[model samples]
Target: MIKAYSISLGALLLGLVLSLVFGSDLAFQRQWQLISGVEPEQFIDFAYLYSLLPRMTMALMVGASLGLVGSLMQQLTQNPLLSPLTMGTSSGAWLALVMLNLWVPLDIADLSAAAAMIGAMFAMFLVIAIVGIRNLSGLPVVLAGMAVNIVLGAVATAIILLNEQFASNLFIWGAGDLEQNDWFWPLWLAPRLLPAILIFLLAPRVLSLLKLGQQGAAARGLNVVPMFLLLSVVGVWLVAASITAVGVISFVGLISPNIARRVGARTTSNELWLSCIIGALLLVFTDLLANALSEQIGDVVHSGIAAALVGAPILIVLCQRQLRAQDQLSLSLPQSRLRWRNRYYGLAAFIIALIALLSLLGQHNAGSWSLAIPDAFNWLLRWPRWLTAVSAGAALAVAGCVLQRLSF
Candidate 1:
């Protein structure tokens, strides 16, 4: 535990320091002075004080909060396949913003944050309502979250398509950029996140009890229902505030706790704290990558995009064998006894290679599709997106296989 934390803390500090060093033209001495509250004499000084500092702070706060809540929920339900993202928070917040922009255009700017938080809370409760209090342990809660996400996402998309003009300003937020021109967002978000202290204070004991099984915990005189709801609402508040601060940065919350467990976070509190550190480390590096890649490629890659690009592959690598669980299913299907064949494997490989070849070389221009090698610039731009797509698709395919196999 000590070694794991020492390494994680060192890496996080290195990432933060590197981000500050490489992101600006100012010297480290001047940066230290700025941190010491010296008055700014140059634009870079002001940028360092305002833009860089607040952005990093936001990233850490949001990342830590997400990781904390994610671990909280996963431990609560004893289900590793859960996170705030999977609980419909993002979609709910998205739909609320869309509706606010449409129906309350005059107050949208002022009320957007509140609407998002409320929407997120509502979505969580809706999922709990679907699964019922007794059914929050496993796949039902996850499915409920998915159902809410699909419905809310579809509605939000439909509204945006119909009212594109009202939502014009939301395009950038939707992409999850963490660039801040001032400390206003950090200030706005900080107090709202104070409730996280409550989680830190209350959750470890409850979660430890929870690990003993619900019946056993009840035997120990823990009132599981009220404690569960209180903790859950607190978790939702933290997640919603993070989402409101940064638009829908997925994977940090989902992946951080999983990584923490892999790296020797044996205790509930240890997992929570380590995941928080890891989450912050991930977002800082991801944000740095987004900024650096944008400079290199002359395309603004948002933090969310960079996160997905990084997270999908890490998730598959870590959880490919771990995400599956044994569950009894009532439904049955006729089993097909098929023998594995080399020709089948060869044919599948051939099809995959053809698709990859086309994906790398195919271009649609002017009215028709043409097959040609991409130039260097296009290759740099396309490869990450393409590889991310492949990773995401493979992850989904694996999940589908798990679901199918788990059912019968």
Candidate 2:
């Protein structure tokens, strides 16, 4: 526990130093003095004081809130895959804002929080309704969440596409920019996040009771529904507020608790606290990377995209390292008695290798295809496409095999 916490704190401190160095020319002492209440002498100092500091504070608060909420939800459902993203909060909030901007004449900037919170709550219920209250601790809920996200995300995307001019302001926010102009957002968000205290005080005990199993807890005279509902509502509120403040950053909540578990956080409270620290560290570094890349490429890079890029691979690796049998599938597949043969494997390998070879070397000119090694120019331009096709196909095939194996 000490080692895990030490690592988390070290990473956080390193991230803070890197964040300070990311886009600022100020020396470390000057930056420290500015943050320590020294007066800003120039625009650069003011930028660091307001923009970077508030942005960092927002990142920590939002990330910690997400981590705590995620831990709470996962413990409630006993489902590691549960998070605000999976529960349709992000998409739901996004869709509400989209519709608000589409119809309401008032500034969406002011109305976004209320709309998003409503949408997030509605989406959570929509998921719960689809899966049923009794079936929350299972794959059914996750599938239900996917269905909600797809439908709502599609609707929001279609609206944006159809009315691009009107919804232009929503694009950057949707990408989850952490850029701040001043302390307004930090001050606004800090008060809303105070309910996290309630979560910390109430969650561990309820979650511990829940660990006793629903039937066992009921037998012991515990009313599970009200407690569960309270936690779920608070969790949803935290997530909605988070995305509302920073747009649609995801995966932090989904991955943090898992990392906490991997690092040996056995108790609910320990997991929640550790996940909070890890989540804050993850976002601070991710934001630093985003800002660094923007400087290098001379174009803006949103923290949301950076989080997805970093977190997706980590999630995949986690999935592989811990491929346990989760909640049963809502639907069943037809059982097949047939077994794979060595010849079948050989045939599949040959076909994949042949296609990959041809894809790498084959060129089409004058409406004809021929297999020949491409020049450096062509290879450089097309390798990503080629790699993506070959790798994606193999990945899908492997995933299908794994799904079949796991399902059966």
Candidate 3:
């Protein structure tokens, strides 16, 4: 626990230094003076003060909230791989916002947060329904979450694509930009997040009991159902708060708690606090790195994209390690009978081929459909879409295979 705290503090200091030094175009001393109200001249431009300081603050707060939520979620479901992203919370929120913008056509500033929270809660309930409260386990819950995430993602993407012009603003937000023009967002989010954090903090023993399986926890006089429900509400609310404040930033929850565990956060109490610290540090550093690259590239790189790039590999490594550990345990068990492998493979291949063929040959002009061989130049346009469909199908197939193996 001490080592984890030390490492987290070191990373926090490093991130703070980097953010102060390079987060803004101004000199370090000048930025400090502006921030501290030490210089009247430096305070003249409200843009620099509001944009830089608030953005950095928001990043830290959002990261910490996500980390807390992630820790709570992992404890609730006992699933390390499950986070807001994987569990459909982020996607559900995004989808709700998309639908609201599409159908309601109102000024969505105030409504977005409510919509996001509702969507997140709905997704949570759906997952609970799919994997019943009694069946709360890592693999089953994660599998249900994956299904919900896929459905929400597909719906959001389809809505955005169909209403491209209307969703132009949403596209940027969906990519998770942390660029803040004022302190309003940070001020808005802080009050909402504090309660969730407090709820989690007040229930450390409950969370610890969850580390014991449901049966064990029940044996110890823990009311598992109500506890899970409470944790789920708090976790989903934290995620919604972050999503509404910024956008859908994936994998912070997964990365933070796992890193905390690696560094020696053994108990739920230690993991919760250390995960928040590490998560804040991770986002601050990632945002700093994005800003640095943006200066050279002459284009802003979203921190969320950078995080996904970095976090995806980390997730792969974690999954690999988990699989290896599971394999060792499974080796001693009787081998399960493999069923319909060839039939499933053939069906998957056929679906991919059919989708690709339709994408390539099928065309609609002025609401009339036609199947024709396109010219060479036209084929180039169609081939990319066909290839994308094929690739997506292949990826989904691979994911299903992995999920099936993991479940077993």
Candidate 4:
């Protein structure tokens, strides 16, 4: 535990130092002076005090909160793969915020947190209902959560596209920008986190009991349903708080706990604390990296995109490890043909034909429709978009296949 803490703390300090030294155009001495409150100049001090400091603080708080939430969620669901993104909480919160902005004409800053929390809770309840609290195991829960996420994401996308003027800020926010103008976000988020942390500390024993499974927990006199619900609500609140603060930083909750466990955090308490440290360090470092690259990448190097780029590979590797472990205990089954395989191929062919037709012959204006072969330059310009769309569809199909196999 000490070693883990020391390593994470050291890394965090290193990240902070690097960020402070190089994140801005100012010299190291001037940056230190500004950070230390000996105001070098009005603009430099204001920029450092308001933007850089608050952004770093937001990264730490958001990362720690997400880590705590992830640990609690994994314990509650007894599933290592579950997180805010996988459970549809982020999309749900995003959808709710989008609706609020679309419907309400007033400034929404004050109401965003409550709306996000409500949305997260709704998404959680919907997933539970779809999978059933009783049937919370294996592929069904993940599949149900994925289904919910897809639907919510589609709705959110539609809302954004339909109301582009209203959703301009929201679109950037939903991509998880950690750049802050002041300390307001950290100040707002810090107190809300206390209750969730208190609940977590108070429920350690109850959480440990959950590892025994629902039946075993009930056999040991735990009120399985209420306890599960309570933990879940706490988890949802933590996720909502983070989302409200940082605007949907993905996979921190999923990555932190797993990394903590791998690094020798044995007990739940140790795991919780270590995960928090690791998560904070991870996000801070990622944010710093993003800041370093922001000039080159423009807005593409936001924290959420960085997290996904880093986390997705880690997730794939973990899934592969689990797959290997499961493969060892294989039970042979009778070989049988997939009766609908030919139909699946036919469906794919039909979809390809439709895409080609749309790309080559579809009318751009309502008044006139015509089919004509384009010039080489025009065709070359159009082909990339068509190819990208087709590739993305194929990738999604492949992802579904991998997920189905992993679930088994």
lDDT of each: 0.84, 0.85, 0.80, 0.80
Highest TM-score among the candidates is held by which one? 3
lDDT of 1 by residue, 268-337 (tens): 9999999889989889989999999999999899898898898768655644444345333312454689
The TM-scores, one per candidate, come to 0.78, 0.79, 0.81, 0.80
Superposed model 4: Cα runs more than 4 Å off: 25-36, 134-140, 298-300, 324-408
What does the lDDT read for residue 147 in candidate 4?
84
Candidate 1 lDDT (Cα, 0 to 1): 0.84
Model 4 error, position 72 (Å): 0.7
In model 1, what lDDT does residue 355 have?
Answer: 93
lDDT at position 184, candidate 4:
87
lDDT for predicted candidate 4 compared with the true structure? 0.80
After superposition, candidate 2 runs with Cα above 4 Å error: 105-110, 318-331, 334-408
Q: Give the per-residue lDDT digits (tens) of candidate 2, residues 1-408.
A: 989999998989888878877758899989889979999999999999889889999889888888888888889988888888878888999888888878884876788778888999899889988888877766657678879999998988898889998888778888888999999889888988887888889888888888999987777777898888888888878887888788888889989999899998999889989999988988898898888788789999999999988877876675455344554334567569998888898898898888788878888899999888889888898889988876898799999999878966
lDDT (tens digit, per residue) of candidate 3 on 269-344:
8888888888898888888877878888999788888788888898878766665454445433356787667679
When 3 and 4 are scored with TM-score, the better candidate is 3
- TM-score sort, best first: 3, 4, 2, 1
Best of the two (1, 3) by TM-score: 3
